[model samples]
Structures are given as structure tokens and as C-alpha cells.
Target: MHRSERVSMYGWIWRHLPGNTWVRAGISLVLVLATVFVLFQYVFPWAEPLLPFGDVTVDEGGAGR
Candidate 1:
């Protein structure tokens, strides 16, 4: 809840991660990449049509004149 609590929580996770710094870094990188891959492959495709970014139009009335 507080700043120290959040920091300690992260510290606990870091301490619990197995292996030395390089191994832990590799594991963290893989986890991050996997999360991104899942989000792009499944989540983004399903949510794309619901987003308002697709069709954009601008009208200048004097263009045809």
C-alpha cells in the first residue's frame, strides 16, 4: 500500500528469483517477451474493432469547389 511496502514486495520477488544476475535477467526478458506476444496475438486482435482509431475522415468544404 505504501511506498516501502511496494518496494519490499519487489525486493522479495527479486530475491526469490533463481540463479545469478544474468540468469535472472534472461528469465525476466523471456517473461516480458511472452507477455507481449500473448497480448498481440490474442488480446489486440479481439479489441481492435472496438477501438475508435480505425476510420478517420477530414472534410474541407472548399476542396470540391
Candidate 2:
């Protein structure tokens, strides 16, 4: 197809992308990252720490029990 014809077609499809699409996409990304952070920082610890290499018996700074 001609360049102009292709541009017009692409423009029409681009216009149909909802105004809120970018907002929703951004919010979704933030939500996903927050969830992952929570899982790693809190949720995984509640269940069990993510890495076995980390201390299972000692708290931070390797203080005594």
C-alpha cells in the first residue's frame, strides 16, 4: 500500500486506543510492582524467607536469640 494510505489506516487505529488506556496501564504496572515488593518484603517472610542462604535462625545483625 502507499505510504499515505498506510499512515491513514494506522492513524485511525491509534485514535481508537482509549484515552484511559495509558492511565490504566500505568496503574496496573504500579500495582504489580507494589504487589511484588510486598511479597518479597513481607508476605514471603510471613510464610518463609525467599532465600535459604539468608539466616533462618538469627535476626538482623546476627544478634543472639
Candidate 3:
């Protein structure tokens, strides 16, 4: 509230919390997103499959077909 006291949120986080905690959190998030992306694109797609034989048609009257 006073002009003499400056608020530093970034400094407070790094000072009060363990540095590795932040780093690990960031790494975990990146890994999670990468896994999801890989699964969606290669392992198993949510929208459409990109397998070796291409998207199969189990339902003949599906929207895509």
C-alpha cells in the first residue's frame, strides 16, 4: 500500500517455494501434453485414426462415411 514497499510476486514464489518444485511442475506439464499429443496423433486419435490401414468403418452409416 505504501510507495516504499514494492510487491514482487515472482521473487516471492522463488524465494518461499523450492526451485525444483516449480521446475518439476513445468516438466510434468510438458510431459503430459506431449504424451497426449503423441497418443492422439499416433497411438490413438480422438477425432480420427491414423493407423497403418487407415480409419476403418465398423459402422457403415457413420457420419464420416
Question: What TM-score goes with each of the models?
Answer: 0.67, 0.45, 0.40
lDDT of each: 0.84, 0.69, 0.67
Residue-wise C-alpha lDDT for candidate 2, range 1-65, written one tens digit per residue: 77766667545655655558687566667767998999999988787645676655855766554
Output the number of the lDDT-best candidate: 1
Backbone clashes in model 3, listed as residue pairs: none
User: Worst ten-residue run, lDDT, model 2?
Assistant: 9-18
Q: Please state every model's RMSD to the true fold in angstroms.
A: 3.8, 10.7, 11.1
Better TM-score candidate (1, 3): 1
Error of 2 at 27 (Å): 0.3
Decide which is better by lDDT, 2 or 3.
2
lDDT of 3 by residue, 1-65 (tens): 79548868755545565448878577667767998899978766554543456756677787786
Q: TM-score rank, highest first?
A: 1, 2, 3
- Encode model 1's per-residue lDDT on 17-57: one tens digit a residue: 89999998888788789999999999999999999996768
Which residues of candidate 1, in runs, are more than 4 Å off?
A: 1-3, 6-12, 60-65
Best by TM-score: 1
Residue 31, candidate 1: C-alpha displacement in angstroms? 0.4
Superposition TM-score, candidate 3 onto the true structure: 0.40
